[model samples]
Target: MIRGEWQNPALTRCDSKLAFRSLNQAAIQAERASSRTGELIIAYTCFDCGAFHIGHADLSQQLAHTVSVEPGCRECNLPIPEAKKRRARACSAKAIYCSDRCQKVAERKRRAQRQMASVTPQ
Candidate 1:
């Protein structure tokens, strides 16, 4: 990836991590784009809360969901967490989490109300 030195795919294959990263990003963009066309929609975290919401990634960030169970990317259709970066090897094939930031954002939002309530004067 640093330089065009890979003259052989077998002898000098590209890093799997980097390959997976680029592929994943492209997939996300494509998924978002498709959602805008009203043909595809990815259930992304509200960023305000961890609740499941369905809306076009490009058009608007509206809240919409039919099921309590969170779904993964439509393209891969794999069970994934809200956000994750590192992919575990021995955990399970159906791992999910696009990045750690997403996971944290979701977690924070999810616990925000609870934490606020605990600190509020009752």
Candidate 2:
């Protein structure tokens, strides 16, 4: 199934391939393409434009080397799953937190700390 909408060739560098500005957008298209085509589709970052693109998961071997060591969440120190690790590799972004709740808590703590620092008298 066709995954994404067509764009000007100048923008994508190719008339056939579709480019997504974010991993989340590419991932959503990948899911739809996977479901329709019955293939393991995945979102990957393009080396040329740094935009995300969709392709077969098996093609990942040509992209980049997978991380050997498992990483833990920064906020809770919990181990991240292998699936998440794969997704992180595709996007070139590390998974800092295991869940959204942990990320939110970390953000709140940072905000509070900033507020406290700003309000304190010298």
Give the per-residue lDDT of model 1 (tens digit) for 82-106. Answer: 3332345445554354555555666
Position 44, candidate 2: lDDT: 86
Tens-digit lDDT string for candidate 2 (1-122): 99998875556464468889899999999999989998778888877666788988765653443457666898888988778777878999987788779889999999999999899686
Best candidate (score: lDDT) = 2
TM-score of each: 0.25, 0.38
**Candidate 1 global CA lDDT score:** 0.49
- Measured by C-alpha RMSD in angstroms, how accurate is candidate 2? 18.8
Task: Kindly state the number of residue pairs that clash in model 2.
Answer: 0
- The CA lDDT at 68 in model 2 is 71
lDDT by candidate, in order shown: 0.49, 0.81
Error of 2 at 103 (Å): 0.7
Q: What lDDT is reached at residue 98 by model 1?
A: 51
